[model samples]
Target: MQGTVDSTPVVTGHEVAAHEEHQDLRVLGLITFLASEFLMFAGFFAVFLVFRGSHVQWPPEETEVELLLPAVNTLILVSSSWVINLGTKAIKKNDLAGMRKWFGITAAMGAIFLAGQVYEYMNLGYGLKTNLFSNCFYLTTGFHGAHVFIGLVLILGVLWRSRRANHYNDITHTGPEMAEIYWHFVDVVWIVLFSLIYLLTLI
Candidate 1:
């Protein structure tokens, strides 16, 4: 007589609860870290508002802020955000190759955006010492650029770890999820900062 057997493993209720608890802890920690980062940016925004209010001419007339390069950079960053999201989806589907390819592309786009910013700075006649607007613009945008760099490092770390360990799937991918959410936060902040510096500065 031949007998057939099912090889699937059953998850116990206790194990499910434990996994949920671990996830909650990681999320709580991430929220706390992000709150601090938000407050730091809020301080910079306050300083900018104060300095702008005190000045009669915000950009001092002589300095020109071109909309072309930054507009292109914004498109690049927004596209990178979508790329990272696709990487996350691939990771969830247990597709390591897909995740790596998408995330690599995301990182490359971010690097390009940063390079564009550098080029803009090099070509611009005004600098950090030019005026209040220059100071605020450089400080805020530079700070956001730093965050983008940090997010890129994190994504690279996730990519490296994913390659090393086979733990990340639809089931257990907290580390990658954290990196992706932080990348999302960085992207959102850039949008707000771009609007404030470029669009609102014209007003």
Candidate 2:
């Protein structure tokens, strides 16, 4: 009598059809989430515009918002977006060391931005209940700052994953790309917020 060998088929994630389907689903999900976020921010922007239009003195005579520090922080935050892209591009070129350096700098820049936000809040000389402008400024910017913090966490996670043995390469990385998109989104939101809150005040 002949004995039979036991061999079961293994299913790897490299199944092209399954992988593509998962990728499509993930991309669609992310877009939907970002769209909902856009609507929320739109509502806040509408509220700000309504209050600004109704009040003759927006910031009032006693309240002042200095533009220098916030502007510097904005530059830092925006620059981080550029820096992290360099990391992504570096990995594309198979330059792991360069990628790590750029990502680390990007994370540091994010930290500096959050620090600047905290400093600004402490020295603003106004409370959340100060006035409509102050209230909106704190609320909108505080939320943006929290998102920046979350982006930093995401960047750090990418950095950590990059250390794994043979884990990521230029064509093989999606997690970092997603994190980059999120950081860029945060940067864009800050730009809009800066225009509405900081630059508008200067005018």
Candidate 3:
């Protein structure tokens, strides 16, 4: 009689290679999307700069853009970037608990940052129609807030998926990786925007 054969199915090396290649393509797609996003934001920045250049006063003589709240919001976003990285690392290590904790914090921080933005909008002494600077300010920052909201949604989705067994592992974590990339992009773009819109005015 023939010896009993083991019945477990095995993953082929070719299958693994193909999965990696697909993951690479997904990452490349995200990068391309972000490139387009950057161009759009650059256009907004150019418009703001044009308006600033033509006027003797940047935000106009009467309008004052507050700094304290935005500074706090900046800190929140920067911290969230770090937190999300921790989550990405945790998922890579197959530590779902750590990933959940860190990503949860990151999502909370993002929500707080967005709330702060809305509060700032409520308190700003001018309206979008008040002047060109005000218009650019609302447009650019509001666009960024929309991105933050999307990032938060993405994080929550990742967290939900993380609930599944073996959903993400060292070699299978494209979702967390992509979400991390997008969140970092959001943070970096915000840093540039904050410097240009808030810090530059102080000089």
Candidate 4:
């Protein structure tokens, strides 16, 4: 029997190879960028430590800055990182529903943490210009809050895109994964900031 048979789909080898190469380049670029960010933050931490050690009485003797609020915010941020990890894991498993739910929770927690920061600022007796302690506290925690805001934006973008394009699959979930990486970094920074700036008050 004479029959015309089409053996394969029409995608060219060059196209497939190009796509893989592009993905590899993207991952490498992200890692490089994050490394640079870590170095910059490390310098800030060094400065903070020097100034913190020089001060005999932190926040001065007259000012009253409660340590409990920032500690609570630290816990919230850390828990949000766990939620984000769950979302990323779900996306890798091709569980879109779970990913959305967990990501939403993570976003909410992050928002709550930011709100707590604002509340703490309101309650802080001294403004950023008042003293070295106030300046350092504001600089470190404010920088961390900005990072949290950016992370929330990234999470929202992924959630919207995942819904629109159904883009996250077992083989392609880099967006959520990268977002989780960034979120975890933010959480870790807060842990250090909280311990250095807040918990140290106890000792």
Candidate 4, 121-172: lDDT as tens digits:
9977678898777777788888888989998999999888888667998788
Q: What is the alpha-carbon lDDT of model 4 when measured against the actual structure?
A: 0.82
Where does the lowest 10-residue lDDT sum fall in candidate 4?
19-28
For all candidates in order, the CA lDDT equals 0.85, 0.84, 0.91, 0.82
Model 1: residue 85 alpha-carbon error in angstroms? 0.9
Residue by residue across 170-199, what tens digits does model 1's lDDT show? 777787778888988898888888887787
Candidate 3 weakest ten by summed lDDT? 15-24
TM-score of 1: 0.85
Error of 1 at 104 (Å): 0.8
Off by over 4 Å in 4: 1-22
The order of the candidates by lDDT, greatest first, is 3, 1, 2, 4
Q: Pick the candidate with the highest lDDT.
A: 3
TM-score top scorer: 3
lDDT of 2 by residue, 5-86 (tens): 6554345455754645434355456667877887887788889989988988887767778799998999899888999999
List of clashing residue pairs for candidate 3 = none
Please count the clashing residue pairs in each candidate, in the order shown: 0, 0, 0, 0
lDDT of 3 by residue, 56-87 (tens): 88888767789999999999999999999999
Quantify how close model 4 is to the true structure by its C-alpha RMSD in Å: 7.7
Candidate 2 C-alpha RMSD relative to the actual structure: 7.1
Query: Which residue runs of candidate 1 sit more than 4 Å off their true CA positions?
Result: 1-24
- TM-scores, all candidates, are 0.85, 0.86, 0.88, 0.86
